[model samples]
Target: MTAVTDQDHTDHTNHTEHADHAGGQGHADAAGDDTGRAEERSENAASEEGTPQDGRSTAAGPDGEDVAEGPEPAAEAALEKSEGEEPEHRAAGGSKKSAAASAGKHAATGPEAPAKDRHARVQADSEGSWDDGLIARRVTEETAAQHVPTAPARPSPPQATAPLAYDGPLRSRLDALRELVGLSRTRLDSRTLAEAGRVLDEAASRRRLSGQHTVVAIAGATGSGKSQLFNTLAGVTISETGVRRPTTAAPIACSWSDGAAGLIDRLGIPGRLRRRPVQSAEAEAQLRGLVLVDLPDHDSAAVQHREQVDRVLALVDAVIWVVDPEKYADAVLHERYLRPMAGHAEVMFVVLNQIDRLPGEATEQVLDDLRRLLDEDGIALGEYGEPGATVLALSALTGDGVGELRESLGQFLAERGAPARRIAADVDAAGWRLRSVYATGQRTGLSEEDRDEFAARLAEAIGATAAGEAAERAWLRNANRACGTPWLRLWRWYQDRLDAPTGRFPARAQVDEEATARQRVEQAVRTLAERASTGLPAPWGQAVREAAVRGAQGLPEALDELAARAGLPPGRPPRPGWWPAAVFAQASMTILQVVGGLWLLGQIIGFMSPNLGVPVLLMVAGIIGGPLVEWSCRMAARGPARRYGQEAERRLREASAGCGRARVLDPVAAELLRYREVREQYGRLMGVPAAR
Candidate 1:
């Protein structure tokens, strides 16, 4: 391979342009130079088919042409020197030169460059010593540039020009979470909602930081050799390693390449503790985008060290828990971190470090024991081709099995998706934490039957039926007063006067029943609230009950007002058309009685001749006929009275129902609707369909 210097690159470009002009001229003089062209073609064919004297094989060039593969020693040394000086500088120079050469060649030859000219040009460039390594470096740089991880593109805020379908799954989930937080802040437990909000905020922050680097924290108990492992992977002693109880006091970040400053800052790592790994070309290439963090010992004696460990651990994309055989089963590690983070198995690694201290057979035993312990801690082990937490056994001091750990990390970095996976796990955990507050089964609302029953209860509570009966009785009383015998009517009037001072009228009794009406209304509301809240989660059930109570605060008073207006009308009940005729018949009987009495008096006093039998018959007929008229009128009034009673009952019942619906049922329904909307949003946040 040979490298293309700046001067050579420029000259090559000029030569290609000159060649294009010469080739066009040659085509114009094709017949005149036929023999010479044939000789040139013969030479080109031999160069293509025959092997070179140096015995170098051919490789495909950037434009699909074959060129010599081996590089001159001098050119290869120069390329290595430049790469050592600065890989970025070498990459930049190589890319510019490669692009220029490719563009010149395409312009000179069009789509189908003549084989003879191509061979000739290749031979000339080969003499000038262009190498395969330079081409390879250019290709690598271009590929890396194309595949660099970028922060996820956030969807623009909702606009008329853009539909929601344009947003990604993450955006949709985040929006759902926002809606849930807004709707359920008052309804749900404060702690649960606060946790969900924290998750959302963290997710947003993570997405906004560096996506190119995967920050993996190396955490372990005191004296676990985690710092040793971090140094081994970095190929430098970036973290302090010693026999002391707490070797690392603060978190140290070692990034393999550039473009992770935002993430490091977010992790709160100071500039003094930031580091770059020193590794060979192949190792550096594999781990180009890794940000390895060395955290303070989790089991440190100092509280601040442990707190720092936890704070850094929360922000990192993944974790490598280094454990020695002695403290592998420490209860603090298992109970405090492992069990609680079981859902994060995919982004975790449990490394059995310092394994060289154990004998070969003992090492295998220790590994198996550690696996059992992790299982007990609820951490899923990725074994036998399953995807879960990775388990590794390595000795950082002895360098035993360190290569395997490095290889695994390289594979992890290649995917460049750790940040996304970590955020998704957090979201899943948040949803799980809030699962109890939401019901997975279908939610029921107040049915029409329930509303109808409530209306009936309200009507009963106001004594609407009793009021209707009272109206019928009043109608009958008035009819009696109109058609009764004069003496009996007079006696009834005197009796009503005697009863008036006792406050025992039907209207007065209704006023005393107001307390009972209020009690019934309260009972009706309580029953309806219970029925509405049944089968719902605790928070939602409480919300429903509260809404019912609020709506029913004035329900009793409103129902009473309705009853008063719809019940028996004021003054005497409406008189039937025949009441007047009945009254005249009764008056005629009264007149006949008076005339007979007068004739009897005259006969006794000898003012006129007396007919004692006729006078007695007249008086008896008057009394008997008066009673018959009154009885007939009462019988005739029965149909009208019954109709009046039913009409009053119907009016009061309907008014009571209307009042109940407006005050109680509507408000409860509105509360239920809000709950359903929030529930659906929660379901979307969890990536599931809500039960309707």
Candidate 2:
């Protein structure tokens, strides 16, 4: 571009624009050379802009009139700027021509002094003239002009807290999802996978565990004293408590440590109330990592409040489900939350709140009834149960069971890994839900018998049997053409040609390549799919059926192509070492017969001495031997031809079956294998040997 500017417009003002816009074209024109273009842009833009706008007189033409723009401020400034950039434009070893053009541009942009003085100044500054001075000065001034005063460096943006790293339980859950997402949604229970995915995302986003915080929520139905319980546990009024039906309208959190700010922020619990527990007791110190949240009533009339409870419930590490004696065994709580969260029983605590309101015997009864409901819900209870969940009777109002509850929370918090355990349980539950998809009580892979049967069906479909019979006939026909008795061989060869006017034999046998064949292949595929899908769930069965017929498109054409390419089992019977002997024996027999007949005729006609006995005996022997030789040759051809036919049949069947395997059976097997793999991955995610 710069070179084009140098050649087209002698003015140096467009140097930057030309170099940027047409650099490639210029380089191509310059034969991959750039130094010449750069030098021209620098020299021409600087030397030629001697305009009146730049405050310099234009150069005189032969008539002494102004020829071009003179050194106005802008012109002089541009010329000087270009001159400063001249050295940068030059290559390490610039050509003499470039240097000359630069020197000429320098001389043209002379100072505006009187003629004699101007000449003297040009001579004085020839080594570093006004051309160089002006270029350097302009370059410096423009560079300075581009500099803007940097404002007090703007304050940095608020740092965004990245979500928790995916590892351990989160990683396992994601890995299990690999198979679940790929599985047939009809069988794999997509709802469970979706829920598990949401849980995984929650774990990643909250990142409380990494923040050294364990978020334990206190959730219960209305009038369950949940907010009061939360306050008693924290030893401060963190949650609003009143006689109001819905005391807590949102999820209020209380962090026992300073590091839980990020955790609280992520939970979206900004305004209700937050407090730090005083370490007056050793238990409080032990509970330092705990961040307790008092959730809105699960059965609240407001949908938003209920939604808040649910949202907080999923994200929390553990739960203390507060229940009064009146609603201790409420089916709503069990069916909605406890039953679904059975896998997370280890982190759950079902507290019989307001125990102070009940008599000793009544309190025991309510606790037992709660236990029964929990058991029925499949929640493993900690006391006298599976040790996965705990049952406690407490009065947040009276602080009766609060101490024991606090101690439990302290111990759970000290473990410093409740979040991981909770996340793992979530994954386990999802895996359990999907168990039917994988654990169908049967092997998932295709058996050899199944494969062989399918292949056989395909072979039948493509008419391998007919092709084999054709191959046998072809081999036999050729055999007779070459090996029969000499006269018969010629006659048979001619007879074989009678059917071939153009001397081109028909195809041994053509595959039907019709819908019947396709239907047969489909049937074989369906059968194989049915067998493979035994004991599999309905969705997987359907999937297997679909997979079995995955590549049905253009199947007939594929079969035809394969058949055409698959030649008959090679059998050139004449190539055998003994075949020549058979032909020779037959030929010899014919010769003997001819010779004996001729000799016999001579004796009968009395052309020679009487030797009728020799001639007649020779003739008889020759006749018998010729028949024997021909019969032997015929007998020899039968075994090889039969064997060859059978071999050809086997080869054709194999080729046809192979095509079936590639186009149909293979895809079906892949689907089954995918199911198996997902099942295995789910098992691993659940931390089990296999899906139950």
Candidate 3:
């Protein structure tokens, strides 16, 4: 049997003993053959209850050892009844012992014993030993046991902080820039939104990585040893240094690797990457994150390369101006580039490179002269004692004073002010240019009253009213003669139309003089209109002249319109291009009427026979009537003709007013609109209120 503790097997054995005692007693009473019954019962009990510590419920052989824990222990009387009949039982016990065993078994066989059988024998035994009423108490005690503690609740992750808004004066200027850009139809001609975006992006990027590195550009004239100095400072051949002028055709960038990609990208150079120092370890450490760009000569023979240098130099954070002993004072370099860059003071370094070529004492004198020239160019270096523009003596080819140059670059980069400042500077510069175009303000269309007044003034200046009066008088003079008495009528009509009237015949003097006077007046009015328009602004001045032409031609055009409306007969028209001939014809028609009337007057005065006089008068009247009718028709149209002239002049003035305003104001308004868009975008990015 496997090992079992005494507590484990005790309960099953007790139950088996009680069973044997009860069975022995019951049989002994019924049959009255105690000894034999007891012996047989002992044998059965031994068979039923085998080894106690084995997995058996009773004292049986192999089949009986099935229980995991021993059954409950036997009461005293049950133990005695099985003692003698078998080795385990006592056979000497009388009926009283058997009866006592039966009674003890009866008590042990109560419900508590079966309940105990459900548990391990040791547990059952211990429980059986307790009062039967104590079982509930034991379960209650076990249920009351304490639980272990748990961990504290963890905290949630935090949200990211937003970018701080820019609340400075610069914001207002940016707003204006956006307005200006909005004025453009497609892409802005000058300051585009792309430029604004670039500015913000550059600023934000620099701000984020501020205090990390400084970018310095080595800018100079074509023949200066800028590349040599760049190479010397880097302590290796980072840039191509040569004897030939304009050797560095592209910008060469050298940086200590704290991510120079952004700078390189901004410079917009293709096939150019960051290079490490090839020579001096100290220079590398001192200039860590300090990028030095060796620009192509600004004054290069090739125009494109010069432009490339100028473009990149504008965006660099700092500049190192390399001056040589020979061509340090070139006027073009000083005037074109250096003077213009006077606003950028924090990052300017002037290096008198190749100082070894000059004598020691002469070096100081030359350096002083260079300083004076720089000052004249508006590049303010420090005074005699103060830290002004950094001027250093260095030989890029010989590696002299390169360490100091590297240290200067290190100091500037170490300032760690973010790129936003540089971007702000650029934006400010751009804004100044844009502001110049739109310095005035928004403009709407011209007022109707103003246009009306202008038109009226133009009409008065051209004497439209006077022209109408002159045409009326001319037509009246011609009409009176045409309607006069056949002999006198024809004669009187022509004479009345002319300046000098005659009694017997209409004078050619009246017609000739009056017609010439009308011509002179018309010519004078036309000249007045042209003169009035002379001092007006462009397009407007042209507009007024055109209007005058429109007005001057209005009478003829109106006549055509009236004739078409009135259904008048089409006649052989006088050609406008043949002004000299038309004038002659008009004068001749007046002369013809006078001559015909005088012939009639001769007959009326009785200088010929009655028959001749009558026929001659009728023919004379007919001949003069056509010229008189045409002149009358032109005079009747003069009122409308004058109004048409006035109307044409008015229209020109009105149109010019609007056109002038549009040219001046519309573009400015568009720029303002674009600038507003940019301001809104910037506000969203920076989480700030847009400037008004």
Candidate 4:
């Protein structure tokens, strides 16, 4: 009989426990109605008696007598029932097992066979189906999962995005630099754009280290011995120095090890890149990034060399001016170079080089005097609370105070690095000037009014009055040539009347006076060309008149003097030598014609009657005599005609040469000078250092 039934067990009861297992057969019977089907089937199989129940068996029915076992058959039928209900029953068992696992221990042991089956069934059941309570069970199961061994987490790969490429800014900057490079051709009048290009390149190169390097140039007048100081500071024979006034014709480079290549290259010095390691420990440490330039003398005869000095000076972070004892007070140096450089107050150093030549005790006095002169020149040499312009007495040959000079330079470099900002300012100023000339709303060229002024000046210099006189004289000569001799004198009378309207011909006294003909010419020139004031104080007005007289006096006197110098007579020849020859030939021809006619008449009479030949001879003498007398009168008139022509030609040549020199060439040259002055002034206003 079955002890318990499947329906009798609660769903929450532990399926793996002994009671569940012991009553397993009873519960199996309740689980299904097919309990004896296995035993009946087992008895029908061909089998032997006393077979183990662990083995499955079947017996034959009526055809053969294979008997079935009764007691084992009952047990097998119950097992079959439990086996049929195993899936639901195992689900029940799994819940109990999970509860036991979470409670920190196993709940119970069980009947060996059925309990093992139940446990196995439970694990398989839990994986197949989700119960409503499994989520809460999952939380407890999650804790158990943590105890279960887990694989370690793997690292992620690096991110993959597109590469960064240069945009327009860099290319645009490069384009601007290219433009500047192209502008090198414009270097003679304005290298500002090219300078700006160099500055841009330098800035870009040193963008990260802008405040670290200093470039200083030593610039001064010719004979100032700037090169000597340069060599002394550099501690090398970097700059050529000697008796020649301007030894450093080009910029010289002296720099420390760091970035010296760029500095030298920017200054456009090639083949001098051998780096000079700093010798002094202090200088080596403090002035690691300094570029010192030994610039050409500012007052050099070579304009381009001077220009190079000015250009490099403007771009440098600091300046050291070398001055000589003799010309330290020169107006040209102070006015043209130094005074205009007054804006660069902080970065300037003034050195009195070769001070050893002066008296030992007089150096200080001279320094004081020099400082005072600088002050007068609108330079504040020493101001309180300011880093005044440094004054050093140095003998470059003797190396006197050279150490001090180096120390000062090093200090300056340490404090104020290269003039990157100053170069930018200069570029900006130049751009402003160019913009003025090349403005957006306006076009630039020589204006009509200016052209008229220039033309007027040119006309005046040429002596419009003298040209007009020459033209009138030409008309007179042509008229006289065309007109009969009687009409020619009438033309002369007309000229005299016209002359009366003008003042009388200048006298010898007036021409030789203090304000002479030359003075009048110059005054006319000055008025037309220079715009000298007609209204002036007494002496200056008189002085202008005197200058005019001097200029005017030169032309006529020049002709006369040239003639005198050549040992020719003071005046033109009275007549051309050809005039007398022509007259003599005409006289000879007329006499020959008259004599020929007389001889023919005498021959004819002699043929007619020999006595009549005497009368014919008298007739021939009368004819010849009349012709000879007439020839004498014509010969006498030749002198006056030749004199007139010679004088006219001389006057024409003199007047024409004077007008061309004074008016055309002089005015054109003056205009060129004016253009140059204006250009220089514009450069000055714009703060362009100097064109290279």
Best candidate, TM-score-wise? 1
lDDT of 4 by residue, 1-692 (tens): 10111211122124224444544444344433332343443343314445533222325321132322122443343344435343222222234433222111101111223433333323322322211111101111222222212111111232232221223543343344344334333322344345445555544554433345576778888878887677555443445667866666677666643434444555665433222322334555655667777778777899999778766665566788888898888887788867765655566788888888988678887788888877776665645656456777788878777778878777666655335434434444444534432222322223456444543443333343343343334333333322223333466678877775322111233435424544544544554333331322232234434443444444544533322232212333234344445445444544555666566676676754435455556556555554454445445544454444445444534544544356343543443333334344434434453231
Q: Which stretches of candidate 1 lie over 4 Å from their true place?
A: 1-167, 440-453, 482-488, 501-514, 552-559, 576-636, 654-664
Clashes of each: 6, 22, 55, 26
TM for every model, in the order presented, reads 0.68, 0.68, 0.40, 0.34
- Superposed model 4: Cα runs more than 4 Å off: 1-210, 273-278, 417-692
Error of 1 at 434 (Å): 1.6
Top-lDDT structure, candidate number:
1
Clashes of 2: 22
lDDT of 1 by residue, 192-224 (tens): 788788878877787776666788999999999
Angstrom error of the Cα, residue 261, model 3: value is: 1.2
How far out, in Å, is residue 564 in model 2?
2.2
Q: lDDT order of candidates, best first? A: 1, 2, 3, 4
| Model 2 Cα shift for residue 32 (angstroms) | 90
- Local distance difference test, per candidate? 0.69, 0.61, 0.48, 0.47
Clashing pairs in 1: 1-70, 1-71, 1-131, 1-132, 2-130, 2-131
* Candidate order, TM-score descending: 1, 2, 3, 4
Per-candidate alpha-carbon RMSD to the true structure? 15.2, 26.4, 31.2, 33.6
Off by over 4 Å in 3: 1-167, 184-211, 244-246, 269-273, 278-285, 302-304, 382-389, 398-400, 417-692
